[model samples]
Target: MEIKDKVIEIIAEQAVLEPSDVTMDSTLDELGIDSLGLVESIFAIEEAFDISVPFNANAPQESDFDISSVASIVAGIEKLVAEQKA
Candidate 1:
């Protein structure tokens, strides 16, 4: 699957919603995901992409990885995956 599609799928699963319900503009908070759910989603994404996310759940606002929106998260993951391949 493509990165954007996979990301939406994983995030939708975390939010207990259908993939079609998730959008690139949707934020985790907007999806009703709590901190724990956010962490779980990160883990799932990491495992799926085989790339570590530079996120600090305890200090989310200070983290290097962007989690402001699904599109930003997808971009970050795409960057990480590209770097890993390099």
Candidate 2:
């Protein structure tokens, strides 16, 4: 699957929703995901892409990774995948 689609699927699974329900503009908070769910989602993404996310759940604001929105998360993953392939 494509990166966007796969990411959406992962996020949706964490939110207990379907892929169709997840939008690029959707935020984790908007999806009703708590801190635990956000951490789970991050782990799922890392496993899915075989890339470590630079996220600090304890201090999210200080993290290099941007989890502000689904689109941003996808962009971060895409960048990480590209860098890994390099």
Candidate 3:
């Protein structure tokens, strides 16, 4: 499966929604994803991509972050993958 599809699958599974309900522009908050769900989704993404997302204590909260959108999540994963390859 493509990275985008994998991301959608992970988000769908984590958010307890159908893949069809998730669009690249869909926001996680709109999907009813709470704090814990965000963490789980992050972990799932890490495992799925085999890349560790660096955690920053001063980083914005998931609520404050804009990773709710599928496009944003894909960009984040792509960034991580690029960093790993560097």
lDDT of 3 at 6: 93
Write down the lDDT that model 1 would get. 0.92
Each model's lDDT: 0.92, 0.92, 0.79
In angstroms, how far off is 20's CA in candidate 2? 0.5
Listed per candidate, the RMSD to the true structure in angstroms reads 0.8, 0.8, 2.9
lDDT winner between candidates 1 and 3: 1
Q: What tens-digit string does per-residue lDDT give for candidate 1 at 1-86?
A: 99999999999999999999998999988999999999999999999999988888788888888898999999999999999868
Model 2 lDDT per residue over 1-86, tens place: 99999999999998899999999999999999999999998899889989988888789988988889999989999999999868
Residue 22 shift from truth in candidate 1, angstroms: 0.5
Worst 10 residues of 3 by lDDT: 56-65
Better of 2 and 3 by TM-score: 2
Quote the positional error of residue 8 for candidate 3 in Å: 0.6
- In candidate 2, the residue pairs with backbone N, CA or C atoms under 3 Å apart (3 or more residues apart, or in different chains) clash, namely none
